[model samples]
Target: MPRMLPPGVGRRLRKGERIVLETHYHKTGRPEKDEGAEVALYFAKEPVEKMLHVHMLANVFLRIPPGSREHKVTASYTVPLDVTAYDVMPHMHLLGRRIAVTATFPDGRVQDLVRIEDWDFAWQETYQFKEPLRLPKGTKLRLEAVYDNSA
Candidate 1:
């Protein structure tokens, strides 16, 4: 289920804008059919002041050999502006073993954002922070994913 934004924060949709839905499907041994996903966009009744955006950190050209125990891939993004991050979602396929996200502030201090020692594709979901985290401009956000492609 998608989360709702707090009051005074909302995303504006332009007329005739395109919306894309990304879905992840898995097989359950038995043959089955997928009925697609249902999405709902709620309009704000009150005034909205903030707009929301999504930044993807991806290494799309990675290749891992079969039977590899611990193949690692990493990606990073530098923050161009100061912003508040409230939710984070990490994605990996079935062979994923672990994943971690960290941020290095401009002052050279590194902070652990999120880490999963054991990663399972079936249990993946968006993680909402207890409070919004402020990321300063020029902060480096790094993501490292480990894969165990052994059968």
Candidate 2:
């Protein structure tokens, strides 16, 4: 997975620091070739203006019944500080059908962040805002995911 960092903010690795990487692999019955992977890091030559933050919204207690066609799960987070949102990413397994994210301001204004009417596990990606979304403090971020568990 590739992520975009906020301006003027970067991370440093201490000497003798070790990083661990993990991946989830789905098994197929056919023989496959495994190749080595590579990682690339980018740095800005100039000073950055703002720092980036990552918020992971997930529902871990899912209980979709067998043969059920539309199972929904929702989660929300409140913004404690004013920040500009640059992108959003929705994640789900093979049973996911749709997903949406929205923001509700303290003043009662609501904004749609992202809505995927059709969810595909094979083509998940991050959606970037055309312009950064300015969210004030006390804004509530909501995420809803729909799944199909039919046999």
Give a tens-digit lDDT track for model 1, residues 1-151: 7688878888889999999887777778898888878898899999898888888887999899988999999999999999989888898988899999999999999988889998988867888888898999999999999998887
Global lDDT scores for all candidate models: 0.89, 0.83
Q: What TM-score do all the candidates reach, one by one?
A: 0.88, 0.81
lDDT of 1: 0.89
RMSD of each: 2.0, 2.9
Question: Candidate 1 — which residues are off by over 4 angstroms?
Answer: 26-36
Candidate 2 structure lDDT: 0.83
lDDT (0-100) at residue 100 of candidate 2? 94
